[model samples]
Target: MTLNWDNCPAVSRSSDVMSGAVVFAGTRVPVSALFENIEGGATIDDFLSWFEGVTKEQVNEVLEFATSSLAPA
Candidate 1:
């Protein structure tokens, strides 16, 4: 399947995609979920436990996408 960033589910802050909320492109798992897990002393294993469908690669991609979105133009 093709990934379309435009259709991806995202939350914005001040019209900036970087400062906004980001959920799974298709699923409802918020990118912040991963951060929340780590902040709560949850390991990678624990994060996967809560979001079985999310992969480590996906988490990385989300961060990368967010970074690019915020990069100075």
Candidate 2:
């Protein structure tokens, strides 16, 4: 299923912090944390295990949003 920013929970910019390679948007969890886990052979279930507040759908949305934002014209 395709996920978009509109359907996902809002991650407030004010609560986010960018430090070098990491982006932390509230939750005190780096946005990369999700990707890192995935890259390390972790499943969605594993990621959710580490982040109880964020759902599988939200993770997909975050990835979708980030992908679009970073896409080249």
Candidate 3:
């Protein structure tokens, strides 16, 4: 199922930002970048280092949101 990011506080989207791509709050970095980096064997720390505008707390929240979305009801 497609995840709805509307309720996730760690991210936001706007017509002015990345052409409305869901990105980490206040940054131009797309949330998809996290998964892409992970799929490419990059660690969380590596992602953070690469995207300085994103915070660890934001990452944690985003990850938690994704996990909770998949949890059995």
Candidate 4:
């Protein structure tokens, strides 16, 4: 199954914003930042504190979406 990224309200990308970079909705922070920071040992709380506008709920939903997408069909 194809993952419908458009259904993810937590993320958005447009040429008008950050040159079409995939970012958390309402924030300039890229989605990749979350993965990169976590890989660098930054916890969810730390990430939330660092980037305002992105809520825990959005992060949780995004993570869940990604996890589900990676699961075996």
lDDT of each structure?
A: 0.61, 0.61, 0.96, 0.89
The residue-by-residue lDDT of candidate 4 on 1-73, one tens digit each, is 4456787888998999989888899989888899899999999999999999999998998899889887989
**Which pairs of residues collide in model 4?**
none
Residues 1-73, model 1: lDDT tens digits: 2223553334222334444445654445666787678789988777867886777777666657666766778
TM-score between candidate 1 and the true structure = 0.51
Evaluated against the true structure, the overall lDDT of model 1 is 0.61
After TM-score superposition, the amount by which residue 43's alpha carbon in candidate 1 deviates from its true location, in angstroms, is 0.9
Query: Distance (Å) between predicted and true CA of 40, model 4?
Result: 0.6
Better of 1 and 3 by TM-score: 3
| Candidate 2 residue 34 C-alpha distance from true site, Å | 0.6
- What is the Cα-based TM-score of model 3? 0.94
Best by lDDT, which number? Answer: 3
Winner by TM-score: 3
Q: Flag regions of model 3 displaced more than 4 Å.
A: none
TM-scores across all candidates?
0.51, 0.58, 0.94, 0.90
Better of 3 and 4 by lDDT: 3
By TM-score: ranked, best first: 3, 4, 2, 1
